[model samples]
Target chain A: MNKPKPDLSVRIGGLVMQNPVMTASGTFGYGPEFARLMDLNRLGAIVVKGISLKPTQGNPTPRLVEVPGGLLNAIGLQNPGFDGFVRDYLPFLRHYRAPVIVNIWGHTINEYASIAERFNDLPGVHGLELNISCPNIKHGGIAFGTDPKMARRVITAVRARTRLPLITKLSPNVTVIAEFARIAEACGSDAVSLINSFPAMAIDIEARRPILANITGGLTGPAIHTIALKMVWETARAVKIPVIGMGGITSAREALAFIIAGASAVAVGTANFSEPLSTLAVIKGIEAYLVRHRLPSIRALVGTLETGAVIPKPRGPGRPCA
Target chain B: MLIENTIILSHRLLKGGYRLLTLKSKRIAPMVRPGQFVHLRLPSPADAVLRRPFSVFRAQAGRLAILYKTVGKGTQAMATLCAGDEINILGPLGQGFPNVRKDTLPLLVAGGYGMAALYLVAQRAPVKGIVFVGGAGADDILCADDFRRLDWDVRVATEDGSAGKKGLVTRILDAWLNKELHGRQPEFFACGPNGLLKAICKRVGRGGWDGWISMDRHMGCGLGACLACVQKVCKRDAAGRETWAWARVCTEGPVFACRDIVWD
Candidate 1:
């Protein structure tokens, strides 16, 4: 007798995915770029790079620097604005079955709302991933993601503009990630995704300057997986809205870790650069894991972490130092 | 593009720290075009996380070759690989050089290992023109013998006066264009460090010669997803209005028109 397959489908707010494996924005350039290397239809969802109100030229050369277990990138959210994306890329992406998630950013709250409203009537776009935490940009990105008030204001304004599933991507640069996650859920954001690359910088000693032309970039890959895992776990516990986990997801083991830590879905970021089929491989590996453990569905494994110890919460803001 | 683990058929050390590593891949050779490159995953012990990008120096029957210099940690690790070893590769990536008319003369320029990309162009060239190559010394003039065999006129310049003329390669090209070309304009092609490409852009812009230059940059995904390797280009819109945009070097081109490039 043939065994039945495990249920891999997952739901992120209104967006239904065939599986819980998605390609992170910026890493997976608007879908068509990786189409020749792998089948785009097989992905859980394709989150394109951040699109602005107008076309952006991005930073100058030497935009990337590879470290031991990760990459530092200051690509500056370079994308074909809202109109350019719809005209040039959306048509090709419409051919694929995967849900198209448009990751967007802007210099102002009005700009973010405007871009979101524009994609509302667009045929192929399934959701909007608000990129308020991109470390590479000069303004609006990390600034909004770090402030709870700004995060609330931006999500609230954009929520009124579009009925599309709103995903507020949180920043690790914040002091309390759970607080921000709660703010998004309170503001009517359908779901929240997080751990947009940590704000980082690499220096060239001889040149006495930064490695990236943008001076600083977002640090991502396996190097930051553990940190992301902790943040995702805390954020998931704080909100009822689903949390899409991402940051240094390279393999099924890592993706599985995020699921167990409470992420509804996982996005493969920097890994796509090294291996184009990493998402597919992770999907297969997760299925194999499910079958091996006799798990009936992917939902059965979500937030299944069993921490044996119960540490007492810290009391009072400031106690006498010993 | 296909990804496969290929066996190293041979590795030869050339002058000036350059090495030619040939891989035995029956699947890749037939698909290779001029200006296309292969992304090589080197066997590094530490810190060299990304796969190195190398231009297709030469591709022949059931084999492909990459010419690289040992300038840093990644190349240093690549230099140690011996024949019979296996290395992972993704290729014939990016758009290659555009086809030229058989009747037009083609002038080729290269500096150091930049010569690697032009040999294939020179090989399939219909009308051969002069080859200008500049290096630090005599040994740095790579693949000159290969061009001589192809019956293309080769000119050499070295900074140390170890070879033909002493000075920059752009000087040699300028002098030749003045003395030989006169009123006749030839198609130009170049690949090298940014400085070399910038020089060609200036000369080509002033002379109004039609040609392209291959660009090099630190790339993450050689398939254009990463947007890490972008070149500023003067693009034309549907209304024929000129606009400056950052184009992907991996997809739009490693080869771009000389005039299209927005040189600094």
Candidate 2:
């Protein structure tokens, strides 16, 4: 029997990726580190580490703390600034076949605009993944992501300056995530990636203090998979643009849940840290799932949420249906 | 540059909480040198979300060994690995020891689990050399037989006097230096706890000895880009500017010249 050629290609914004499997920002540092472990060319796209207008020292020691099912990291925004990124790291990324998405962070609104404009003209640059959801730093990291209005302002400023596709990464810390999704779409963001790490804390009972140097850090991995799914569902339904979902997608089955919830593509974050070849595992899992279900392409799975699918209501006094 | 072979040799208990896992990969072995390490994927699919880094304890033919103490779910899952089980393994990564001359009197020092890294150096070192080991007690001591079989002069020190000498390994080292048994100044190599390495560095002082020490730090990419595994080093480039540069232990080295390291 002839095995079916898996159709994993996906399109987001103006870019057409060979597959929906992309490395999450921060988790994958420019994609070269894992090149020895797996073929970089096999990936759909590579999201580089977060870049800033100026060099950042990031957080102090004990920056990472391990929890029950995830990890908390307060690694500030450590980078060599935009100039260094373009001059030093850009050339290395050009060697790979996959599109390179530069994850950018800034201290102020103007900083985002200026850096976006600079990256807009760089060769081999695919798009900009605006990291507006970083929670480790004292300023501007989570500031834009927490407030819908401020989120709109930052995305708007960057969108006006660059022709490059804009991917606004949303933080799950906010109460009304759907509202934030609407605000980002209205402000001209080409697409949106939902649910950056959740803010969390871990304590060392023996030491009688927090495990991380920053006292608190952003939690990521399987522990928050459900939360990420819910946020992606709400945000994807609220916006017309594509939503790239990520949380604790360790296998193909988990990633399919995000696609069903309305995500166009999925990013593998903390899972990459656990396995050097996790991206490939996810790709293989998705392919196996497609073959098992006899689906022709991954597109057939996206936004396939069944209306009749059971929706479990919160366990409390029932209110009248809207 | 390629994966020649990969196999799970054995997974067994080391101490009460740790497990020693031996994996065989020839592609990595051919390129591996002392002080380099490989990143192993933990078996847990959810709870542990990062590939744990283990020092290259011993690499030969197509096999490499790693001694890890299971302090969490990730390592505990690693302990469950059985022979023939396929696990993801990345190369004999990071810069290793500078190829020493045949005549260099290599002196190897290890403390506790630090022996995981020093074991390889002892095996590969010149036929005539000495190895000093330190552990909390006899139970914590590892690979004493391996070193003994190699015909290298093996010195053991346990904190509780359950082994060879009573007191810290550094004290044993001081005695060796004062006695000057070998008649020639030895080139020292050490990897262990930070506290032990710090004490050794202080005793040796600047311009006193020629040696290299391996450092351990939290790593993100295991590559140089993340800057998460930065260690202070006194480096001099082409321009002769003696500056403090952040070196990644995963890439630049898990092994560095003793004089180049900035002890804090």
Candidate 3:
């Protein structure tokens, strides 16, 4: 008899996926942008770009710039409104076997609730990845993802308005990310996705001007991997709900790091830009790792980090390290 | 429209840092339309930069070539690539130049290495026409002989007075419009810097003739996912109202109609 295949299935609240690798919102346009390049059915889930109630024109030219190990972008949530997305992208997404998680964002609590209510009625939407951590936008994004109170209110408002599973995408700009994770759980969030691009900026020395038209953008890529891994571990420890870890995930090793760090699932972000097939590579790599380790399922690998020999506490708090 | 690992047949560096890279591909080369580009991932110590896009300079039976100048860290690293190296490429992408119209005479315009993008157009055109090639100096002007070999009338202009006409290309184009054309309508096919494209668009609009210009933008994900390369374009609504919208340069076009573009 053939050896049994390793199970890669994972679940986050009501959303069930074939695998644990998902496309980070915005990195994977609705469904068709990358459909021609790779098989969409293989993804754990597909998170389309962020969408709002009304169509947005977005920011001006020069929306992106590259640094040593990351890319900064200030796209300002340019998207086809709900109506446009439903008319143009939904039917296409429904054709795929992968679960469709529509990433939704709004400038106000009311806007968030309103769009949430609207999407709640949509049949094809599997979940809502609430984008409160987008740093490039002028309002609503980092403002809600960073502030504990606003985060709670928006999550609560959206939770009440929509019955779909809510995955709050958190910001890394705050001092304590775990506190926000607790708030997301307290406010009825089903799961939490951590570290949406750290707020960042780059400058042109010769021109002495900001590289992006929006002045500052969000940093995403290998540069933020370690930082995001730590945050995912912290948030995972602080909450009972599944943690979806992301930020600069380029390979299977990195995705496995998130799972071992306690993320129930992982999303491929900037790496999608580098390699359109990065998600597939990550999915394949994760399976190989599981088979090598003899894990029963991906769920068995979640939060399995072995911190061998914990360091003794530093002798009291000394003079604040300068 | 497809991703393939193409083998480098040749990597040659010409003077002025311009490099011509030839790759052998069964899928990309033979299928590429004129003005389309390939998203090339050059090997580096760290994969920091996103894939770089280069318009197909020449494409034919299982082989394609890209002519690029070393201007950034990506291209600088790409220079180290040798023949027989395998590079990952997503290619033959974006809407390319449409076929020449039967009723109008074809006019080719290029700036500097922009001639690389228009070579296929000249070769594919049913009838030969005037080609306006301009640059800052003699060294900057490229590929005039290729057009001449194909029997297209090539006009060279250098701003520094180091080659051909001692002024901008507009000086020579104005002279042609004043005497050369015996009233045959001209449809322009241009690929160049924004300034040259704008100038061509202006003349085309003024003359009420058909024109297409290939656009160059700072791109990420040469796929449409990144939203990095966006160009504001005119969109027509149900009521026939002209409004503005952002079009992804990597997907919708590296080529667009002269009249449809809003310069601002």
Candidate 4:
């Protein structure tokens, strides 16, 4: 008698993931750091910490300060720049079992294209994750993410440089996320990951001042999981390409919700900080959910939105669906 | 060695701003030495990214324990953890102390929470060694009973005079070295605030003495990439090519020889 194997395969853009779970950029730090703690091979894909055209010193001390139910960091995209990342990080990443997606950030549209062009032919780099939303820096950090026109221009510029699959990371601090997702899609972005950090702050009551040196920080944790899911659903519906949903996923159930909401795959960010094995747990959870539901593959759940699905009415004072 | 497994055995309060957390990981425990640490992901989600590094206070029988002071939200959340919980822990990382020689008289020195990093060495050192511990006050002094149980000479000096000697631990070390410690060759193992370690290094000098110190720095990607935790060293290559590169405190060392380290 043959035992059933778990259906854990997932595809995003042109890359195939053994599982839908991946480590979010910045959180996993280039993949080698966690090697001593866990197996890098078990992960579906490792999205390395954000890289830029040039080295970044990041922000000053008190760069990270903890807040309620989460943390706030103004690390300011501190990386070794493109040359160092390619020379140093990419070589080691090739040894890992999973695909390595290098997350790139830049100060200008051409800078993004330049970095993309540089990495277009490198070995071991499976895809490019455009980190268009970074709140910790001063320059083009959050510029492209917050404005649709800039986002399109940045995405278009990079698209013109390489054939590598592009995944544009979206920022949550926008008024219309669906509009931005549509623009990114039209600009030739292969997939979109939503949403990046929600700009938030925490104050030190005793000091009567903000805890972080940079008064504001990006919020992430279970506190913003729902918000991320909503954005992912909206973006997935707005664009024809895949959506890599991530925000506050700490377990398999939460990951499944993203899949049901139309995310082609999911990224586990803050949950990694809480539990290093969280990505593995999410992958296991997705497999278990698929097996129990009698689904043949994960693709069945991707973009499974039922048009005209009933909207639950609020239990309080009375508003019926139109 | 790779992390074979990880389990949070227990998390309990010890005193003000301090906690005793036990992590059971066979992989980390087997390879860990005194003065090394593990970088733990603080259960915070991605956007609030970054892992916090904690020194390995004690390791035995496939288990590692850390004594951490709750300074912020990351540690506060760590404090709330209970038995059977698990956090992502990457370690047995950084350089640990050189193996204690049988003939040398080992001297273990620490300050405040710094005691946490030195406790294991004190317990493991040969019976002939002396353990000199210091802290802000009596509350800051830790693991005295454990060291005493090992039959090592355990001395305590507190700033507020609420414990052993009525002065700073360095003063006690100075007095002991000049008086009772005369003519003996003691290899020192120390870990504490940079200023305190600097003062100790200055007094001890580099002649006829061998010692190791563990340094601390803000780190990102505990491996090497971010270059957030770089430290200077004193030595240079044969061609005077500065053999002292910017060593990563996370991977290259959390511990280094006293003569090799360049303290600011």
Candidate 5:
């Protein structure tokens, strides 16, 4: 007489998420910044702002600029050190029902391992989102993420240090992103999240200078959505491990596309800045999609995109032939 | 903080291309404190992914108002909003100006539309003192009468000699400190451009008096999550050693003490 509730649970390595929706790091801050606005427990996981080995001060002022469909931010990975996060944020986050994925970054391979090692015995942390891909930072962030050999070294070093689920957040700047994903798999990374914001710039024509103090910042939001989707599709096919898709997801439609393309999960980044209730909305939308399509569970939707057999439909007059 | 689909009660253009937007937000209006702001998602600028933050000019009953100029794409888009249109707003955000101390005289300083942020500060002050406002010209000055209606002494200054005093607001303030001073300690609440705020900060530092400044920066997320609007402020440890730290302007401030700011 009744239909069953669609099962939305997803897992990234050992961490089990109630749904596939996650709050991207940097955009979500720590778990508490948004807790007052939205339920922290509702998200699949809360991927907090990146943390480093030592306390980082970030960049100078004029750190953000809004473009047509997105924004460019040069926040420069400003964050509390590993100890600072453990002491100030961990206890508060441990109380949330959703898993806490700490985004960790460093200036060197050793720093990456050291940061990972500190979180090993931490009671609250469910996983580490290795942020080798932040484009804003001058040093470790942009460097380690773009270089293939270095990406392997950093992932390997961090994998050796922490027993927690390791996620290598890959950069979109690379020519072939799948090669890096395969490297992460080889290095023992449990999952991979792609793509981080694209390296971008905005200029003030009147001032004749870059709008951001850092000149170049990472671009995120609707503009990068399609590009990120392609990268997710590529990386998903490249690795057997879970692929967490992110970049410009503002609603469930984009999240669904990610899942259909092959993402095991989706992370809401810039959308969190615009709408704090977006994660809840995305989760609800995904469930509605599942019910509408009569899919038994979210797992069934993963990599369900049909390919290689479809013909194109013709548009109205004056359009090129399909 | 709340995100509400507030309906526009009225939208009118005042002197100098400024738009005074009134919204019926039973959920958020009553929660507003002086100097707090609302981030509006403009209807036009469909490509815009960020919400623009505006200072609360007035909040009462089940309605709130923000007085802003058509400065950028976002505000220009806001000009297209009319009565009964729904607008998404996240509000009563950031810390507002603190209460005027009992023993201190409350002096309100503003620059142009900055006066909008200080109205409640003036109305709520236990004692009414002098209000000094400045702008580039008469067209740039706004809301001087609103303060006058509140029975507070209002002083005006324009750089082009088109208004009250023929120089900066600080010049008139200096004159008051010299002639009107019978040894009354004044606590200052100011909102203006960075230059005007820095000038007020200099005076606050010299007089050893308290001054609160509302800073306006390019904000990405009005909620402190984005780390887009950050101001460096001096922090002290248990040992009293001072270190400068980046405090989010969208959360820790929009209002910060003049003394704590470490200007770049």
Candidate 6:
């Protein structure tokens, strides 16, 4: 009478991930780069670096800076472009068991839809992650993601182009993240991933200039994990579409924080730089925690936060009357 | 690419704050090439989150060595490590130097600890060539004695004129290329500071010598995933218009052809 394994499989949009741990885009390269280091099939999904319609060289050198608890990068979404990725990278990626979620971006709304339409015909790609909120790029990155109308327009346009599941990666720079999340859901988005790296910069005083060549870069790591959790909690309550939470998730405990806060799944970002096998370790840890808690499935933990509905008035402290 | 716990065979203090660390890594040593590097995950978890990338200085029978200067907190902590300590490492990563013809003369130039990556390249150099070692003073020129021991020609240059020739090593190279090697254009190989690399790349591009340079950058993941270490690369369009694009220093190259790199 052996106990059955805790069900780790979870579905986001239409893509059913074997586990809830996926590698965030930009952290994981096209695929073959990390395949030798870790078993790619074990991952829930592989989100590669953001792709554009044309090959982009990205930013200048000295694009990275190390802060207290994180890293800042202005990589400018450098990629091999859409056609190059399909020809050079896609064939090697097709061999892996993991589903490939192409993270695509563009400078204009028309560009976003056109890119989405191209990926729609690609054979190996399972889903599309719309990177409408990258802070590192100067053009339409955070532009469309921050504004509600712009987010709606881009999501609606992309939704019309591709039949694949769409996940809108939202920016934390917005005043209210839930508003954008709601807009995505209303505009027919299949899912939403929150808290892309926050805008940050480091200074080299002796050099008398910013540490990053781009002057400012997106900050990602443990420093932003707590903020992501808060945003995930709010966005989950706002939209019916599954919420994928990520920001400095290095371990299973930190990832579980998102699950408890109502994230259908979690993506490992900056931690991948420190430990290539971190995402696999996180998957194992999540399953172990479920088994330890006697939970049958990961869904049981989603949105289980107890907000203390009935607050008892302060009774004895300082003898204050209510 | 193997990640294993490697035992430090020896940690000797070299001149100019450099430490010649020898490690017994059976898994890594055999695969390492001239310009490849190993990512060392320091033991201190609280301080060093990002693993430091050190170019493979020398590799031999079941052992590899890295010649590193203690500059930042990561290298400073690396200095405190002694022999018999096991350190975690991931390597022989990035593309190594391109193979050169056995008959071609190999001219090697290095600055500071950047010499660490060039020693292995020089060992395999054919015919006859000169090794240009430069530093702030004589103490900064690493592996000069090692190269000479191999019966290779060695030339030294110090900024303060405390060693062989005064001024920068690139200046010495310029003088040699213009004056002595008038007819023979030796294949150039260099590893040094960005300014030094820039000067060398410019010279090689203009001088018409086959040249390769090993670059150094602040990297997050020594592997290609992080996209942290980027350099501008020169590319030509259909119209032959020169254009520049970002190239990952960790993946596309730690070593690149002179024409491939666009000097700023």
Which candidate comes out best when scored by lDDT? 5
> Candidate 2 on A1-322: residue-level lDDT in tens?
9987769899889989998989888887776677766888888889988999887767766677567788788877787788778788788888988999999989899999999999877888999999889999888978999976678789889989988988999989898777777777778878899789998888889999987778888988888899999888877777788999999888877788999898989998877765656788888988888889899999999878887967653233212111
Candidate ranking (DockQ, best to worst): 5, 3, 1, 6, 2, 4
> What is each predicted model's overall lDDT from 0 to 1?
0.88, 0.80, 0.89, 0.79, 0.90, 0.87
After superposition, candidate 6 runs with Cα above 4 Å error = A307-322, B45-47, B126-128, B178-182
Write model 5 residue lDDT over A199-233, tens digit each, in one string. Answer: 99999999999999999999999999999999998
Candidate 3 per-residue C-alpha lDDT over A1-322 given as tens digits, one digit per residue, 9 for 90 to 100: 8656789999899899999999999988897989998899999999999999999878887999888988888998999989999999999998989999999999999999999899876878999989899887788888998777788889889999999989999999999888888888878889999879988899999999999999999889999999999999988877789999998888899999999999999999899887999999999999999989988899999999888967443233222111
- Model 5 residue B243 CA deviation (Å) reads 2.5
Give the chain B TM-score for each candidate: 0.96, 0.90, 0.96, 0.92, 0.97, 0.96
For every prediction, compared with the true complex, DockQ reads: 0.73, 0.42, 0.75, 0.27, 0.79, 0.65
Model 5: chain A TM-score against the true structure? 0.95
RMSD of 2: 4.6
As a TM-score, model 4 comes out at: 0.82
User: What are the chain A TM-scores for all the models, listed individually?
Assistant: 0.96, 0.94, 0.95, 0.93, 0.95, 0.95
**Candidate 4 local lDDT, residue A122:** 87
Question: Please, what is the TM-score per model?
Answer: 0.95, 0.90, 0.97, 0.82, 0.97, 0.93
Query: Which candidate, 2 or 4, has the higher TM-score?
Result: 2
Q: On residues B47-108, what C-alpha lDDT tens digit does candidate 3 reach at each position?
A: 57588899999998899999888888998989999999999899878999999877888988
Runs in model 1 lying further than 4 Å from the true structure: A311-322, B45-47, B237-241
Query: Once superposed on the true structure, which residue ranges of model 3 sit more than 4 Å away at CA?
Result: A309-322, B237-239
Model 5 steric clash pairs:
none
Query: Residue A268 in candidate 3 has what lDDT?
Result: 95
Q: What is the docking quality class of candidate 1? A: medium
Model 6 alpha-carbon miss at residue B127, Å: 4.2
Where does the lowest 10-residue lDDT sum fall in candidate 3 chain B? B41-50
Write the number of the candidate with greater TM-score, choosing between 1 and 3: 3
Task: After superposing candidate 4 on the true structure, give the runs of residues whose Cα lies further than 4 Å from its correct spot.
Answer: A1-7, A36-39, A305-322, B1-30, B38-58, B61-93, B101-105, B148-151, B176-187, B193-195, B201-211, B215-250, B256-264
lDDT score of residue A322 within candidate 1: 15
* Clashes, model 4: 7
Model 6, C-alpha of B87: deviation from truth (Å) = 2.0
Model 4, range B1-264, lDDT digits (tens) per residue?
443447888887886578889988877786788888888876554434567789988899988899999876667767777889777677767888877888778888888888789877876665457778888888888777777777878889998899999888888888888888768778888888887778667766744588888888866556654445667777675588755445667777888777777755
